[model samples]
Target: MKRDIFLSELEILKGIAETLNEGTELKAVLGECLRKLLQLTSLEAGWIFLINQEGEYELVAAESLPPALTNPKHQALTQGDCWCVSRFRNGTLTKASNIMECKRLENARLGNWGDTYGLVYHATVPLKAGEEQFGLLNVAVANKEKFEAHELSILESIAYQIGTALKRIHLTMKEQDIKIVEERNRLARDLHDSVNQLLYSINVTSSAGIRLAKEQPIKEIMADIQRMSQHAQAEMKGLIWQLRPAGLEEGLACSVKKYGEMLGLEVDLSVEGISRLTTLQEETLWRIAQEAFHNALKHSGEHKVSVVLDYKQNTVVMTISDDGVGFDYAEGTFLPSMGLKGMEERVKCMDGKIIMNSKLGEGTTLKVELPIQQRGKC
Candidate 1:
């Protein structure tokens, strides 16, 4: 019987681990987790309360509790009023019995109508990971019931499991956020270098041209205006490149090679058999190649670049490298002169790997590999 119970707990843990790792949002998963956790642990009512940015534990979800829980006045939850949540926020494990009497609830109104609720025992535990407390889990029941000592131990284990899992999810999200910021930064840089300067020059020259055009007597100055107009037209073409992805339908390799030729660089793009690839795989390859070409010309200032696409086992891979001065990528540093970080982020979103190999004067090579599972129509 003991072995059966242990196996059951393991199975529940497996289910929880799977659910948490499914890339589901933390709040949604935690709400669902509370229900499963309560059922698994044989608790009557369980709730997961998340601490807000202001450090208040607001009831996120409850499996069962006071019907009046819907009413704010009935819940004792207040700003900075939850001890378990606060503890978790600081990465501390805390457990308390008779949870209603906990410090946060002592001064709480708890709503006078829920007197029958007071007779039940409540336990509060911190849901902790790292040094941050994302929330608290509470188990409550009215009427006297004894909690087995082993049961409390198991609860502690569950809390630890929840904390570690939550930390992993948080880390993944943080990396994604950083990548998004990097992409935006790269786009801004592109505009500044390729579009902004040209437009600024055009504006200055156009103003001068208008002043000269006003003087019909100065035929020599008219030539200057005509020259400035040619520069403005060139700037407009650069803007068009910015407005549209130059090579998407033709494939990423095509885009990269086109971009290289446009920049007067010798670029060779290679593609192996991708007859079995879905559209998502092809698009991702295209984006990666596109970004790689942009990075080489605009950032590396390299005159030559190469892109290789291949399928190895279940992974689709794109490798782009250039013979330019390489910089340290391990520092997690984003140089304004380089858009490497932004390129890294886009690859990561596809559940891909971005490996940079470089040394000073040795040149830089970027390899992105992704496990392709079809997410769109073929």
Candidate 2:
């Protein structure tokens, strides 16, 4: 009996591992895994939640939920707060254990919402990879008030596997995003180097032809050619700008200054020390600078902004400041707003640091520091 039980657990784990390894889409993977786990363990239901850094929890996967939880579009599970989630947000639920009772089920029973199928308790496990906590895995069985010790242990192991898989998927997605950005930049560079130069040469030659032509027809033809070339050149510039910032090849500072000017802002730009940055580093910095400039223009109530770029000790530092009105800046609360989260993600992808300071009625300042040596590491 012991050997059979061990083999059963092994088969369950092997099946789950294969499911996780073969999947890339997060919701689909979690749903399939939950289905398999519940079937193997004879549990009645399971669900998974993915919590972001902002303490927002999303119902990523669920399987075999009773009518009480699923009726009216999963209102019971998705809408209200539950004990496990509260504990998770408060940093109390760190391991797999039997929660005393399922709050949602109890509430359903009290409210006479629907049939719960005798589900009164659940096992909650924290999903984590190394030190990073992602979310929770919860499993419940009908008429079961508690889970066995070995059951909790197995759930813990499965949660760890799921967490690690989530980490891998996230990293893969990030890498793909980076590659897409790099490829777009490369295309922009090609257009600027080859097509843009050709258009410029055509415009110049047509202008010279108009100047030297003696016949009226010849001069008119040259003028028409010049106008067409100019229009095409402008369109090309717009396309390149969509792919990557203009003047970026000259330097990061130049690109940012030009962008600010285009946005109708008075940019006071200064540069110190020579910069040794990779293409990815330059791209990341330019993006962050653009976001800062945009925020200043929209929210700061000031037309003039200051930008400082400095390179020293193999690190590049940039500071963007606005003298207009600023809002209270709390790292935890404000990151998801004002496009700051996107900037933070870009910096993190490059293994860099970003800091922002702001206060009500005061101005805002954003600083970014990136190491030159971290280029290869990222």
Candidate 3:
């Protein structure tokens, strides 16, 4: 019987390994793995939370959640803090163990959300690859209060596998992002060397023709050509700017101010403390600033925007605000239509924090904080 149990455990591990190796899409992979785990363990339900460095948790994957948790689109799981997440954030949940009780579930019961399916307790496993902790893996059985020691051990192993998979996915994504940036730089260089030079040559030649022309009609034609060539040159430069920003060579502040000016906004830029940032950090900030500025240009009716860059003891903070007519904005929720999702993802990739505030009549504010020291994981 012991040997049989060992074989069954080994099979489960093999199945999970296959699932982890299947793909790089985080939510799909995690959801499939959770489903497989619950099936093999005879557990009623399971969910996964990916917690970032700033204590913000995302419900990345789940399987067979009860009505209480599912009603209103998993609001119960996404909105509030639970015991497992609090423990994970405080650095106490180092391994697999039975948590006291699921706070979210208790809230659902009290709020009369719906049935919880008797899922009041669960085993929480801290997912970690080596020294880096990713998040938590939780499994629950209806009316099952405590998990066996062997069960906890198995869960620990599974969580370790999931953690390793998470690391692999993250590294792959970073590599892809780096490659994309490099390609964009190469394309920008090519455009500047080829098309931009050609346009400049045309403009210069047209201007020389206008100066040398003996006939008035010829001079007028040359002037028209010159105007068209100059316009084309300006358009090409704007395209190259989109591909790769120009003024970043100077500094982030210079780049941001120039971009805002190009967008026809009065930029109030301020900087404090010595500037120290990695290349990746600078690029991330630049991209986020571009998005914010574009959003402000499209939505905010104000003509001026304020930008503040401050360096603290261990972090850098950037605040972009405009005093225009604003739209309703939630703190954690990002509106898909406004292109804030990309900004959020970029910040999260760098282990940073982003906070947004807006009201109907007041202006909008976007603040991002990034750690000074680089982490090996990111």
TM-score of each: 0.48, 0.70, 0.87
RMSD of each: 15.1, 6.6, 3.2
What order do candidates take by lDDT, descending?
Answer: 3, 2, 1
Q: Which 10 consecutive positions of candidate 3 have the poorest summed lDDT?
A: 1-10
Per-residue CA lDDT of model 2 for 1-378, tens digit only, reads 121112377878888899899987778888999988877767778899876544657788999888898889558888888888888988998999898877888888888888988888988999999977888999887777777788788889899999988888877765776798889989999999999999999999999999999999999999999999999998898678768886787888889898888778999999999988877788888878777877888889999999999999778899999989898888546463446787786676455778888888989988898877662211
Residue 196 alpha-carbon offset, candidate 3, angstroms: 0.3
Put down candidate 1 lDDT per residue, 144-179, tens digits, no spaces: 344445555666667767777677766666566557
lDDT of 1: 0.60
lDDT value, candidate 2, whole model: 0.83
lDDT by residue for model 3 (38-137), tens: 7676778999998888787888899999999998955998898888899899999898999767889888889889999998888999999998898899
Model 2 ranges off by over 4 Å: 1-7, 246-254, 263-378
lDDT of 3 at 279: 68
Better of 1 and 2 by TM-score: 2
Model 1 regions lying over 4 Å from their true place: 1-7, 51-55, 79-111, 114-119, 130-134, 214-378
lDDT of 2 at 274: 91
